[model samples]
Target: MPQELEIKLTLEPAPADDAYRWLSSLPETSVGPTKRLANTYFDTPDASLNRLKAALRIRKAGDRYIQTLKTQGEFVAGAHRRLEWEWPLPSAVLDRDLLLATSLVDSVSLDELKPVFETNFERRILMLDDGKAVIECAFDRGEIVSGGQSVPLCEVEFELKSGQEDRLLYWASKLGEQVSFFINLISKAEQGYFLAGVHRPASLSAGAEPVSKLFHGLSRLWLTGELPQEYVEAVAELKAKETKTDWRTEIELFERLMAEPSSAKVSDLGKAQLALLRTGVADE
Candidate 1:
């Protein structure tokens, strides 16, 4: 019943300090000290847990450790909404009983479980609220280690604690005015799986063709409220298909609002994008 509603975006062409400062400078934001977190993700022999769209991990926060289970949920309005369960552990070891308590009870077997990958990062957090919306903004910087290979991890996550999804998008649009970022749908767990040569997210398949690939990239910019020329061309192709009722009409409006982000209201495009978050049409 506990769901995590969060959106992640990568800061591009902007220094880490700049992103930090920008979030700090925002109104009604309370800053917290940065904390280094080390997380180890686990899976079973055949990766049955991954197949179930669930990730199990034990996190080390200073002297404290936590075990968490998260399901890869649907994307609504460009934010990932997933069911999550967390418990404080006495140490860094995974608790078998806790794993059995989650929705993944039937799929989890303690004996076969093994460590897959790890994500170690330093997180700087801030709470942003203006009575209407409360967002836990986390700017994480560090690296994800796997198979003797690691990728630098730096991204900001805006998790909607409570309030309308539009409110979270509004603050993101305002943040985009000063910094350049791309919406990233991939979660840390998914990234590690791909990095570990264990699993590939379904989103990567969107790039199999030219048009879908373009649209996939375009979707990543939904929060920025800035429409690129390339994206306009991509949407044109997507709009060409006639697969679902009202889908065409929706894309038409998206095409118009996406044409000029400056003149058009950000909320309009945001709403349009959210409408298409789950494409109603498939190419003929």
Candidate 2:
């Protein structure tokens, strides 16, 4: 069982090209080949798989098609930890027998799985080696399409290949400074479901339980750069809770976020948001 560890961030839409240029100019990184990835995510119309906190996708990178299943995992600050399984397929279709081989054999009805959305993007990977750590920084730019609705998918992922998360966080913060970005907690599959239909159920929070609502609110504010009503309500909920030494950490962080001046830098605010999110994981 290989669990993935990475920090996924969404680049500001307008400067996506600038992000690519900046990545190419990095003196410390070894730029790797670029590949266009077309990934189709599947699940029953009722989103039974999503409810189970898993995602299924068949990716077409060049001529090869790979089936991937990612189980429910953890997310904190800007980092993700998830159990992932991948298998090669003959073409772009799901292999029932192979899927059943996994632990979710009984959780999902194999026959009902259908394509709900697709993510077609170009990925530019850069290898960073600083003697102590090796990281793969991938810049992804594309669109997530489902039915007639589509949303832009512009993200940068810092995946730890041979080092500590401390290194990963350092790189994540560096990228946030160079490019206008926000920590992305929503998976592409979840975003697809959201675009497919609002009536459908979604498990979009990358945050764990308890402070899931706060995570949701903060994620929205970071992605869109606007504090919505939902965020206000989420903060209010946190404020209403008693501040115990242990559980009040999130509440205090939320307060700190609110106390931040309107003149704060974008990158600093982003870092603060991540700090607040990290507390949620600590509690878990």
Candidate 3:
């Protein structure tokens, strides 16, 4: 429920391959069916600012669903560490609301731990739909409450199917690994957004640039209650172009503009200004 670490790791290039060998390599010991999932995301130009997103995710083990109003963040790019937190209330799909937090640690690349976590053995027969396999190793850091209630104390997951959970363990075990990392929902979603380097608006302090103030400053001339007409127009146009835009690039531009000495970073102001440009037209 509070702030915590959420991370992900995506294969540099994803590959879809056969499951027979990996499955056969498993011990007779049994486990339930584990589905393969692919998610495609759609977002407005200010997705990072709004902390909002829409996506279509399908898993081989279940039906596809529409995911709306999702939020994501990135700690850095490609050094293979990321974080994410999401609310269960799907803005458009399903019923009820859930809260989750998670992170992914690409232990494979840690130089300090490399003596045990590194791997070099290659396989050419693996069936990767695109010649790349992604492994999303995640962790959830929650707290344990009293009264015998075992709340999620944060969870870590290894989300690669190219190898069975057992095979993954083999590699990890060889490296003297002792931590328990299971695959789960919170971790998976975290991985998806981390791979994309999602943005987050800077949290301003008292006497600093408040987000609301930024919006007010930018929309001064077109001021209106709640949302100015210009702001509404910008949101509408942004929504229309969301599916086709490169959200990350736009996020960078927004961050740059707002960081300028005399710039305004208000929500309405950002919308209105972006609406007049070709870039932010898709930013809702």
Candidate 1 TM-score versus the reference: 0.75
- Candidate 2 lDDT tens digits, 1-284: 78888887766656567766776677778889899999999988788888887899999999989999997587654577899999999999689888877877888889989998899999988888877789898889899898977888888888889876678777765665666666666677777776877323333443334344555555555444455455555567555655433445435545556555233344544655555544444343
lDDT values of the candidates? 0.71, 0.71, 0.28
List candidate 3 segments past 4 Å from native: 2-24, 28-31, 34-40, 46-61, 64-284
* C-alpha TM-scores of all predictions: 0.75, 0.79, 0.24
- What digit string (tens of lDDT, one per residue) describes model 3 on residues 217-250? 2222221112223323323343344355454444
Ranking by TM-score: 2, 1, 3
Query: Tens digit of lDDT per residue, candidate 1, span 150-219?
Result: 9888888999999887676677666665666655666788778878878755442433432433344454
Candidate number of the best TM-score: 2
| Backbone clash tally (model 3) | 30
Candidate 2 local Cα displacement, residue 11, angstroms: 1.3
Off by over 4 Å in 2: 198-213, 221-271, 274-284
Q: How far is candidate 1 from the true structure (C-alpha RMSD, Å)?
A: 7.7
Displacement of the residue 105 alpha carbon in candidate 3, Å: 28
